[model samples]
Target chain A: MTFSDITIHAMAERVITYTGYMARWQPDARERLERAAFDLFVEQGFASTTVPQIAARAGLSTRTFFRHFADKRDALFADEHAVPDQAGRIVAEAPDGITPLQIVASGFDAVAAAQFSREKSYYIARHQIIQSDDGLRERQLHTQAALVEALRSGFVQRGSDPVDALLAAHLTATVFSVSIGRWLSAESTEPLATLLRDTFDRMLRTAAS
Target chain B: MTFSDITIHAMAERVITYTGYMARWQPDARERLERAAFDLFVEQGFASTTVPQIAARAGLSTRTFFRHFADKRDALFADEHAVPDQAGRIVAEAPDGITPLQIVASGFDAVAAAQFSREKSYYIARHQIIQSDDGLRERQLHTQAALVEALRSGFVQRGSDPVDALLAAHLTATVFSVSIGRWLSAESTEPLATLLRDTFDRMLRTAAS
Candidate 1:
């Protein structure tokens, strides 16, 4: 068979898990779209999958897909745009007396319990998909950069000197980046919250020395 | 004038200071080519400028330009590839009694003295040019990631535990990245070495607290 024929054949078998006849009427249309999108992305590669294909696989219309995501890349990173805003809110809500690093800790602790605890599988799948696309990886770096900015501004608002604020934000980003990296890449069963705290503590010791 | 005419006319007037008749035969062919590339990148924008333009502007052949740099992008980041190896050497040469963080500090101090102090102007210009291009910005992130890895492995080589080594390398990278950023963005005349040292000290306090 031709390569195109092989791909079409494989797609029919692969669409079983993420699609259903009644999935169009599902309550979690967003989740359905994401599942379908991920399935299509994995089968055909990110660049080869179209939005209409993803929507059709989920038994939804393209309009519904557009409502759920601005574009295919947006579908891949539905929740990332919230990072800087969420981080800013956490920073703004903290007590007036907390250290900048402690505020960073609080943000991590919050993200882990609220986001990662229930969505570990989603993150793992997303990470794998993103690793396969340079454009997605670049978008990932932009999100990380935004997180750094969010923390940096928070530190400034808390009255740290400029240079100290810089250091604090970078430390927060580093801990988050590294812990999440280890958490996702390793087969460890440790909770992300615990891993984050442990990583921050080790960073503290290194920083102190 | 039409936009195209405006661009072509502007290019004519922009090829000054970075080109000369004897520049191709002069010492430091690499420096002359870099100066020419930077001038053209700034004048006509990086995306619009070609290798031939840069070579012609530098009074050099394309072959000579190739000898100095792999591409225009490579010209923007000539010395970056040495960072990891240089950091590794510093890590290996330090006394066994030195802390991982101290080794990091030594590496930074060495780099600041050896590279940044004398080449501050080039860095400032390079930072500006890189900021304007998404591809260049992505490459910048990649370089930063490499620096993190280099320091991480250096910490491990110095006998630190895995987590602590992660922390140490990140701290080193954070300090380096932040100090350099501040040095470039701000108008302050402080040397990079001093900024780095002070940033590290502040990080230590925050970490200790």
Candidate 2:
């Protein structure tokens, strides 16, 4: 468990068991790992690619690969893997009396503005890789499901009714997902946060018959 | 590539041969297998119960179990597997001039009325099993996501905007999921269909504010 004593398998298990963190010890290492995995995934299919191969291609140790991703399947989703924690912080600190949905809106707006604004190409590539395979798409769904659970817990912590909290969580995720789909598909000058807020507002407007 | 997979492949071959011999003699093999799997899942937990054990407990072969369900994760969701086909039929034949939400409402109402109306206890058990295991719950979410895809495509087939179709699909899934949560948690004589309808209505009312 210590930095001195870790095996590749144990590191992989730890990644699966958590939204793991890495020190800012080597930021570029994360990108190296990502780029290496992306190239491997393109050369071979996702199912055929292995973590050790990715690590080797990246010129990093398997220990370093484990720090950035939960598994080989998660290497392509590094940015998304970080969203629940980032959004949860804002949800946890929102001012009182606003709706759970409103809190979720603020949380997502902050995330989109901070992270999604400049990651257009990265996300588009992820979308293509994920869409090409059924298992990857299901993994994507599970990833989003995890995000919903995080939002639901955050809303519950803020004293919303559990049912309302779950509903709000799903709404927030839908807006985030649909906005990303639009953002990646278009080459508009508008910011992702603007598209996300617009999607949230429009979804609410269209919720009724 | 693992020893376990080789064993499973050998078991599957044996099962296919055994299933044909047993089908003529064991008319209730599927039901018996389901009952055995359900009991084992309840007693030993989902992760611990294996397909071979369920087959042995049922006095059936693993092939018979596979014939009825796709895998151990799917054993508890036998009823849900039939839903997309059932609802897709209705969505495919809806009248024009109605909104996508209305199409979704009708589709869900048909599904709930036809299948979910009297299966309260069955669903409660499935919910308990699924909620107890993170993997099972994620599988359940995937099942729902498949239903959304069915709904979305059905809407698109009717010439609805793809974005509108997708948003309506998520909205419908949210309603379907929330209704099931409400239906199972409380002891009420009200039918599942009625609860589903009410939840859909209430979600729209709350969605805008």
Candidate 3:
């Protein structure tokens, strides 16, 4: 939805008030909007929340919210797209002589390090919200499919066999998905990249057996 | 959508006309409806087809169609639910000493034997449609998720660790997915179960490397 003029001015004032906080963290408008939307989703439920409310909470105009996200749901997953993008980049740039599955595993580890390390609590809460709703689950599945596609393309571009590339991509995505679930539920303070690597190793061992 | 009374009576007559055909194959009303639905879906894209058309083509009532499928999309996937049900049953009845991943692989093999062996062309066509459409892909993902859950529950029921169960279930599903895509595309006349077994072996080898 488009922003109202009044809300735009209000958001400007709110941002000015939070200038010190912004300076400390340097979180861009998109990140701020995502955090605010997720908080509202956890508080009032995804179905009950509105874009205006998220924009207001993030201290941004509806215009600024639209500039960052197409809608509230898009805002929630703005950073999620970065995982696959980074994974693709990592795979594409890896040194020669690695197998397709090795490339995928390494890419997944890179993504976990970049995106999932610092925001443990935030991700856990978001995961809970996604798990509780069918719509969110569908969105998550779509997101995952996108990642698999990206990995498959990366493998193919690296001159791997197409069929092998597909298998490696699906395998990597499956390992990443299982690892994320375990990482979210884990009681220890182990990094997500470590958990992903361990899970990938265990999965390979089990599959081999 | 519910059935009209006129369509119901017409279906009764139509069924009588097809009595000879039905007697030969002995397919139930649900199977007939699913076949008719798929044929129509292939002829006229999934979005263009209607429920009444499927029931009419199948020599059944719209009421009977609804009894079998929730909608046109449901009709296309009538046999989809059987995979998880059969997998769960196979897992539950497996002899002792099998690992969770082994059990899941066996269950997947059983499902492919029971369901995917007979309708190669039909499944290939349906897979093409599903790959082309977002809605069908989402439904497929949901179906895959359900199978993973079923496999996970089966593992837990057999006293496997919850985290390990999840990992095994996801790995099996991923292999199954990759196998099906390859099986559908293979030019040879190999059985789906064989393809699945071979793919599982290859995936294990790749993952190990």
Candidate 4:
């Protein structure tokens, strides 16, 4: 081949490699931002931490940090949106015969499996940071409200009555909150899904009684 | 009668009249503040209303407003703390044979009777103002959390298991929220107590099913 042909081929190969790198870069940046922000939040407090410091720790630009998170607080809840989606999908795909309450419990199980199973220490740290700040706590409450709304909509779309759907959604959110509180406590050793299921059963028994 | 006896009797009558006026003034100030704040909030959104404006509209000093509420937004929830107190009292006074769920439902019924029954339009307006503001919404959620904690503690004090108490508390909060939502909806004509009873029955059925 001619020298010009060889040069053009190498440049084309470099362009293809650069495109692949760009494709992977966004998620990597988000992960790095979350890790750095969490470390800072734990070391200092959530209120004391800054976006620029997080970006500096993550070896990213401030612009990149903004691209990933709306603010430092948002970094702590990076996966907040995924929770409702996971729960809703599980409810939507459950078998036809299950009660609405059961469907919601299964959704909680699915969320625990998909989002919370592996990040034990991370979640514990995040919980501490969130609990320490009023703003973070409010954001967490908002997130749960969104999840409950998603669960309610999921039940409604599946043909459950509206009030039943609302009750089941609220109940599921309550059980999830209780299970997570237990799971995050230093005294608990059980898996979150197990805790969720147990809480659900207890709630049912309490209601029935 | 002696001159000294006539003077003492006059002094006693003046003290009684002044005491009666003092007793009425505190609640009158609070009611005026709440009415002023609600009117301002409805006229020009919650965010746009100021504490001074609310106080001025009430024909009271800002100091009096502060004495009644911690802030302008607090005027909207002046009765929020009374809810848990009323509910807790009901739970504590319930009969021995009553289940935890039944006790809680009864507590909710009592609160509906004492607070919500007489303030339909006021609550409807307050709900609109709260819905329009994120900060107010967060406060409302925090208030609910506090109520849940109060309910849980009440159940625990009455010798229930901790987890069961938590579940019962959460379930009660859920039903209360649902009932309030239904009662406040534009299409609903049922009383809040009827909605609470209906919701509690539905929840029990849903759980048992």
Q: Which candidate number has the best lDDT?
A: 4
Residue A180, model 3: lDDT of: 80
Per-residue lDDT tens digits for candidate 2, residues A1-209, read: 54423454454555433422433444587888888899888888777777966876666667777877889877787776678887787888889888877776766567876777556776777678898876677778877878899998998998877777788888888988888888888666667888888888778866866
- Tens-place lDDT per residue, model 4, B44-123, is 89987777667666666666777889998898888888888887888788888778887876565568778776668878
- lDDT per residue (tens digit) for residues A95-208 in model 4: 998888767765655677788866688888888898898788889998999989998999899888999889988888888889899999988999998998899899888988
TM-score of predicted structure 4? 0.86
* Cα error, candidate 2, residue B12 (Å): 13
Off by over 4 Å in 3: A1-28, A101-109, A186-189, B1-27, B101-109, B186-189
Off by over 4 Å in 1: A1-30, A61-70, B1-30, B63-70
Give the per-residue lDDT digits (tens) of candidate 1, residues B1-209: 56765564455445433444456557787887888888888788899887877776776667678887889998877777677677777887888898988887776678887767556777877888898998888888788778778877877877788778877877877878878887887586888888888877788887776
DockQ of each: 0.64, 0.42, 0.47, 0.55
TM-score of every candidate relative to the true structure: 0.84, 0.75, 0.80, 0.86
What lDDT tens digits, residue by residue, belong to model 2 across residues B160-191?
77777888888888888888778888665667
Highest DockQ against the true fold, candidate: 1
Model 2 native-contact share:
0.41
Task: Flag regions of model 2 displaced more than 4 Å.
Answer: A1-31, A64-70, A73-77, A92-97, A103-109, A131-139, A156-159, A186-191, B1-28, B62-74, B106-109, B117-119, B131-138, B186-191
Greater-TM-score candidate between 1 and 4: 4
Model 2 clashing residue pairs (backbone): none
Supply the DockQ value of model 3. Answer: 0.47
Pairs with steric clashes in candidate 3: none
- For A166-206, candidate 3 gives per-residue lDDT tens digits of 87888788788777877788575777778788888887776
Q: Which stretches of candidate 4 lie over 4 Å from their true place?
A: A1-27, A107-109, B1-27
How many clashes does each candidate structure show, in the order listed? 0, 0, 0, 0
TM-score of 1: 0.84
Interface RMSD of each: 1.4, 2.4, 1.8, 1.0
Candidate 3 residue A46 Cα shift, in angstroms, is: 1.4
Between prediction 1 and prediction 3, which has the larger TM-score?
A: 1
